[model samples]
Target: MRKILVVGAGQSGLQLALGLQSHGYEVTLMSNRTADEIRSGRVMSTQCMFHTALQHERDLQLNFWESQAPKIEGLGVSVAAPGSWAEGPAARAIDWVGKLDGYAQSVDQRVKMAGWMETFAQRGGQLVIHGAAVSDLDYFSRTYDLVLVSAGKGELVSMFGRDASRSPYGEPQRALAVSYVHGLGPRPEHPDYDAVRCNLVPGVGELFIMPTLTTSGRADILFWEGIPGGPLDVFNGVKDPAEHLSLTLELMERFTPWEYARATKVELTDGGGTLVGRYAPTVRNPVGRLPGGGLVLGVADVVVANDPITGQGSNSASKCAASYLASILERGEKEFDEEWMRGTFDRYWDAAQHVTKWTNAMLAPPPEHILNLIGAAGQLQPAADRFANAFNDPADFENFFYEPGKTAAYLASLS
Candidate 1:
């Protein structure tokens, strides 16, 4: 059997490891934290996986929480009117909900990753619990037929140098904060069905309210993407969970008062339910060279770390794993050479570039045409549904998102 070492038990690493194990490969999965530790730790992400990404998990029979998690039927957008914020209850300039063809769902990574780690072990895959450094990867490279770095945090990331041509930003785009809570009242506009609520505060930033299944059971995630140094960027030093929830609600009241009204009675699900941080959206070279001259291929965020403004982090990771699995299976008895590594990443990039482009575009102020597209969606049901479903397939954005002419043409057709 071909021996493979996957460093990082995240969405990509763990999924790829399990897939390889199913194919009779000798797979060793490394994680910095054990299942127990991960279950008891802080929340990792606001992962709202759409249909295509969710289907990948189902194909692997790894969608354990599918029946338990809430079905997100659509995505709604509410843009705060000019001079509406802080004046009182925020008034919406434009508001509409776009139904997704297939529902999306959010299962807290704390719940998903922990369950997956235990599942990986039960399925006979080797699970190693230790923080992996470059030296560690160098040593593993000697024993395994292939080494892949899926850990996108700490020193492991520095192994892969940034690809300057593909990476457009040098500094963080948004200051991010998140709080998972209970008692978040349902949206009155759509009380019968669940949806991801995206409330735009224009220059200040955005507030995303997503129904989620967490360790504590059914809950909601309140996420903020604040422009750096802006008024919404206030979660930097918050340590107390109560204080974090306090700050999160305070901002909601100030900027997205409509959401604030529903969140007034909510409380954190657990002490680990809050998170805050930021990073530049970047694309890095696929292969990393170790000091010992061994090579490791970077996966997911290690290669393409787009800002969460578009909520594509988890979706991107899932697609990367599925794409890599196919590439590895196709290699047959051939060596896992540098050429093969680049080819694997190139194959994945063919799909990821759409995500990267759309995500990077979202980080900046929406251009006039883009703004017009969003506004017109409010009056056109088909436009709204098409826009909502794009969250599941970002490649569709290439049709009308990047150009004014296309935007005008698409809306005209809808009219």
Candidate 2:
């Protein structure tokens, strides 16, 4: 292999570049700008790389946290329905997404991504600061031996062309609002204050709060969701950034009433919020093989894992990279075309579908099993804990993505 050209320099792209380079493959990472742009204290999307993602990093020995990054200890997950009590022994709590003192670490992926890219460059990997440019590649010409497209953006979908059967996605794409803010005006701390949280508030959507080591020294992140073209888009008519944060804080106070009872009210400070308006697309075929040789494909959030309800965006790509890398290393460039990409991705597709479908299923009117299950938990205390922990247990984790039946079975065991 002469050199692998990787498109898109996001988290997924960085991971693939590191993996390939570590395996002694020649790799050139091309992005809109140099890694220095990413290192300029900008955080794009917030991702909780749970233990699995961290293990992948450690396994590759890709650590850049000596000076700036902070290590995350754990995650607190609470699943609450709107208007429900969120505190006390009587209220229900969801399972923690990570094991105690485990490998899950919260990171400003933008910074860490740049650090890894710098490391890649130091290790002799080529860095190309080309913006939206790629030489047309045809395998017969044998231009690069292998061209891996990790492009996580929307336009990349058309690259592999289109296929009907394997790529049927029925859901429409939706816009989301994500912001990292600070000094949200201050709330008194609770007696038992546990920071670093992930929450799912029914009807109101999800928000993940993580501790960040930034210029402000310590900052928090808030990920908010709004219906496309809805009132929230214009910050519900608020004109300025502080006003927007105020509106979000206002809404948060109203909706997070349950959490507000115990958790500290966010104190918003001016100029501390950075908002990214994102449109996430749904995809059943994020991974597709091109018709010719010298090409293999994998889609991360880059391609379309917009189903953030499942948090598979980053993890899916990491797993996909591992799978795609394996496929390429096994079959070599000539054999690593669309077909083999399909074969390796089949495993990823099956795993992701099982969990995401179940997750998205929860958003709508509840299914009978869910109703019965939640109803059962309400009636039987132990059953609820067991049922909710389905998102955490190792067996539940494995089966959640790999075997829905097994996940169902684990839940059934408690009943």
Candidate 3:
């Protein structure tokens, strides 16, 4: 059996390790936290999985929360009126819902990652609980036939040099804050709240509200993607979950009053339910070199670290794992050298590049064409549905979303 070392037991690393183990490869997964620690630790991300990504997990028999998690049946987009931003219902502008072709779901990473880690161990995969750094990669590279890094952040990630040609942004795209809370009442006007509600305050930032399954139970997640130095970028110095929750509510009241009204009764689910940070959308070279001169391959966020603005980080990670798994399986005793690594990464990049493009487009100020598309989506059910479903396959977005001519033609057809 070919031995493989997967550093970082995150979505991609764990998934690939388990997949290789099932295929009779000797797989050792190194994690910084054990399953118990992961379960009891702070929240990791606002991971809402659409159909394609969820299906990838199901195919790997990893969808443990499918039965218990709330089904996200649609997506809602609201654009708040400029200058009308205040603490009341009058601050709203236009709101509309778009039905999805299939449901999406958000399972808190604490629940999902811990469950996955335990399952990996139960299935006889070798698991190590230790932090890994670039200094250790030289030894790891010699020990395993192939080494794959998938951790999203930290010193290990810095080992993979930024590919400036592919990476457009030089600094953090948004100041991100997320709070998971319970006790949120259903929207009074639209009580059937089984959708990912995205409120865009053009020029300010965006807010995403979703039903998420947490360690405690079903709850709501409010994620703020604040443009740096903007009004929504107010999470600095807030460490306590209650304070985080209160600040989120205050921000909502100031920008999205409709959502604020619904969040009036909400409280942080736990001390670990809130997080604040920032990351530039970056694409790094897939192969990293150690000081001792060994090369290790990077997968998922190690190579493509998009801001969670478009909710594509985890989804892209899953796709990368699936693609890399296929490539590795097909290698069939061939050397896992630089050429093989580059080829594998290129295959994954074909799919990932679209996600990066679409996500970056969303981070920028909406062009007139995109505004027109959103308007059409509000009025036309088919347009709305198509737009929502595109989230499932971001690659398809290139056909319409980023191209002004295609978007105009699409809108013309919608009429």
Candidate 4:
């Protein structure tokens, strides 16, 4: 069996490691924390997995929480005018709902990662509970037939140089804050409660109210994407979970009254259910060189870290793992050299490029054409459905989302 070392036990690393082991490869998965530690640790991300990503997990038999997780059946968008953010939801200029082709779901990373780590061990895959650095990877490269880095944090990720040509932003597009709470009541407009509530405050930032499964049970995840140095960038130095919950409620009252109304009695689901941080959306080279001159392949966020503005981080990671797994399986005893690694990354990039572009566009101020598209969606069911379903396979967005001409034509056809 070919020996493989996967550094990082994230969505991509764990998934890839398990997949390889299923195929009879010798896989060693390294994680900084053990399963118990992960379960008790702070929240990792606001990971809302759409249909395609969830299907990938199901195919690998890794969808353990599928039956328990809350189903997001549709997407509801509300656009507030500039100063009208302080007003009530009645002041919103546009409000609409777009039905997804299939449901999406969010599983808290604390619960998901811990469960996946345990599953990996149960499946006979080796699990190492030690943090790895660049120097560590240099040594690992020589011992393993193939070394794949999937951890997106710390010095290990810095080993992969930024690909400036592919990376458009030099700094973080938004200051992100997320809190998982259980006391949120259903939105008055949709009391049945099965949709992602997206609120866009023009020139300020965006807010997403997502249904998620936490360690305790089902809850709502309130995510704030605040434009840096803007009014909504108010989550600095918030260490207490209760304080964080309070601040989130305050922000909601200031920007999204409809959501605020529902979140009036909200409280953090657990001590580890709140997180605040910022990250520049970046694209790094696929291969990293060690201090000792060994090359290791990069996968998922190690190569592409997009801001969660479009909720694409976990989805992108899932797709990357699936693509890389197929490439590795087809190699069939061939050397996993730099050429093979770059080719594999390129294959994943073909699809990831669209996600990056679409996500970046969502982070920036919308152009007139894009605004028109959103406006049209409010009146047209087909346009709304297409926009909602785009989250599933972002690659299809190139056909009608990026080009103003294509968007106009698509809108016209729906009339």
Candidate 5:
């Protein structure tokens, strides 16, 4: 059996490891934290995964929480009108809900990752609990036929140098904060169904109200993507969960009153239900060279770390795992050399490029045509649904989202 070492116990790493194990590969999965530690840790992300990504999990039989997590039937957009902070909810500009062809769902990473770790062990794959460093990889590389780094954080990330041509930003784009809470009431506009509410406070930031399944039970996620140094970028030093939830609601009150009115009674699900941090969107070379001359392949966020403004982090990771799994399976007895590594990443990039382009585009200030596209979605159901489903298949954005001419043409056809 081909021996493989996967460093990182994240969504991508775990999924890939399990897939390889089923294929008769000797897989060793290493994680810095054990299942208990992960289950007891702070919130990692507001991973609202769309259908295609969810399907990837189902194919692997890893969708354990599917029956428990709320099925997000649609996504709604509410743009704060000019000076709406002062004018209140009555001044909201564009308001509409786009029904997704397939429902999306958000299961807290703490819950999902921990459950996956235990599942991996139960399935007979080797689970190693230790923080992996470059030296560790160098030593392990001698034993395993292949080494893959899926952990996007910590020192391992630095080994993969940034691809300057693909990495457009040098500094963080947005100040991100998340709070997982219970008791968030339903959106009155769509009370009958659960939906992902994206409230845009133009020039300030965005508030994503998500219905989620956490460790405790059904909960909601209040995520803020604030432009660096903006007024909403105030969660930097807040450590108290109560304080984080308080500030999250206060911001909602100031920017998205409609959401705040429903969130007034919410409370944190756990003491560790809040997270705050940020990183620039970057694409890195896939192969990392160790000091000892061994090579390791970078996966998921390790190679393409786009800002969460587009909520594509987990989705992209799932796709990366699925893509990489196919490449590895096809390699058949060939050496996992640097050439093969690059080729594999390039194959994954063929699909990932769309996600990278769309996410990077979202980070920047919206151009006139992009603004027009969003505005027109309010009046056109087909346009709204297309835009919402794009969250599941971002490659569709290439059809109309990037070029002003295409955007105009698309809206005209809808009209």
Candidate 6:
């Protein structure tokens, strides 16, 4: 029997661990903290998981299958002028988000992580608390057939191999302040307002509002986005995040629903709804080889890419876990040697590179004509929907990555 050890209990690690167990591998998953330690109701960032992502999750039989995950109503996207962010061409996306087979909406990340860990253990998976820290990590034995690392935190980055991209994305961490509110008005007037309201402000960054089902019977709004000089940084000295948050929302009110009027009280997690800062640091393609890789493999955020802006982190992580598990099952421990594991690492990187490239390119500043094109497309219905779903298509992904042909296609297909 091959003994596999999975480090880091984040979503990626959890998915990989559960996947390996299902394939009849002797897997032991050890996370650094307990479930309650990480649980919090703060932000909503991801759209529904992609169809390919959902299928892999089901094939692996991840724990949250029966849990209350979202059935995405649709995507909420906006395109506005560079300076005037408050008002712009708004687009509502339902056909894509709402119709995704298994997952169109979202489940809380904290909940899913906790749920997966529990289920993995219930079905005879091993888990431990307080495993190896990245810097202090050193493999004791090659006894364990394979060791997979999927730590999302920064500490995990140093414990991996090199990146191999021409001009990989930069390391820019932004501060985001989020809060859940009740007693808000009806959804906005945007076309897909019934599904999701995406506020796209070029200079100000992004703000996404989604209705998520927590344990609470009533639907709650998760207000979230990353700001350059966000409240957490500018008001770092304030010492009261609740107050800072209230002010932040007030300043950015023009883009959101008219809900600020009814926010009676705010429930702050981590003592004030202050998240331990988030980053979208980019590096070259995952290293084909690490210094001392007897058989330690990279998974999810740790390997392929990092950045929640594209909302591909979680989906990519889930898919990577499946692919990683499949590889291990096909080839036993012997295949995990430094050379072989390097190949697996390369395979993982190759799979994620195209999507990462596409997202990174789109995130960069656009030219004059392209901006106008996006503005025009945002004004229409079908064009906007196709623009959003194109992310799920590889041809579109490549088009977006290499050229503006896809955007041109959107122009030609306008309603």
Question: lDDT of all predictions, in order shown?
Answer: 0.94, 0.55, 0.88, 0.89, 0.92, 0.57
TM per candidate comes to: 0.99, 0.75, 0.97, 0.98, 0.98, 0.81
Superposed by TM-score, candidate 4 places the C-alpha of residue 415 at a distance from the truth, in angstroms, of 1.0
True-structure RMSD, every candidate: 0.8, 5.3, 1.4, 1.3, 1.1, 4.4
Q: Between 3 and 6, whose TM-score is larger?
A: 3
Candidate 5, 55-165: lDDT as tens digits? 999999999999999999999998888676764552578899999999999999999999999998998999999999889999999999999999999899999999999
lDDT of 5 at 303: 99
* Residue-level lDDT for 184 in candidate 2: 34
Better of 4 and 5 by lDDT: 5
Itemize residue pairs with steric clashes in candidate 6: 72-104, 72-105, 75-93, 164-285
Model 5 worst lDDT window (10 residues): 82-91
Best-matching candidate per TM-score? 1
Off by over 4 Å in 6: 40-48, 63-67, 80-82, 85-103, 134-137, 161-167, 180-186, 190-194, 215-241, 254-276, 284-293, 391-395, 400-402, 413-415
- Residue-level lDDT for 205 in candidate 1: 93
TM-score computed on alpha carbons, candidate 4: 0.98
Model 1 lDDT tens row, 1-415: 9999999999999899988998999999999999999999999999999999999999999999999999999999999986776557678899999999999999999889999999989999899999998889888899999999999999999989999999999999999999999999999989999999999988889999999999989999999999999988999998999998999898888888889989989999999999999999999999999898889999999999999988899999999999999999999999999999999999999999999999899988889999899999999999899999999999999998899999899999988
The 10 consecutive residues of candidate 6 with the worst lDDT sum are: 92-101
lDDT by residue for model 4 (99-141), tens: 9988999998888889988988998988999999887888888
Model 4 CA lDDT for position 46: 90
Candidate 5 segments whose C-alpha is farther than 4 A from its true place = 86-90
Give me the overall lDDT of model 1. Answer: 0.94
Model 3, 1-415: lDDT tens per residue? Answer: 8999999887889889888988999989999999999988889998888998888889988888899999999888989887676444436566788888889999898898898889989988889998988888788888889999988778888788999998889999899999999998876646765989899997889999999999999999999999999988989888778888888888888888888888888888888899999988899999998888888999999999899988887888888899999999999999999999999999999999888888888888889888888877878888888889988898878778877999999888878
Residue 10's C-alpha lDDT in candidate 2?
A: 75
Q: How far does residue 164 in candidate 5 sit from its true spot (Å)?
A: 1.1
Error of 5 at 24 (Å): 0.9
Q: Which residue window of length 10 is worst by lDDT in model 4?
A: 82-91
Ranking, lDDT, top scorer first? 1, 5, 4, 3, 6, 2
Let me know the TM-score candidate 3 reaches against the reference structure: 0.97
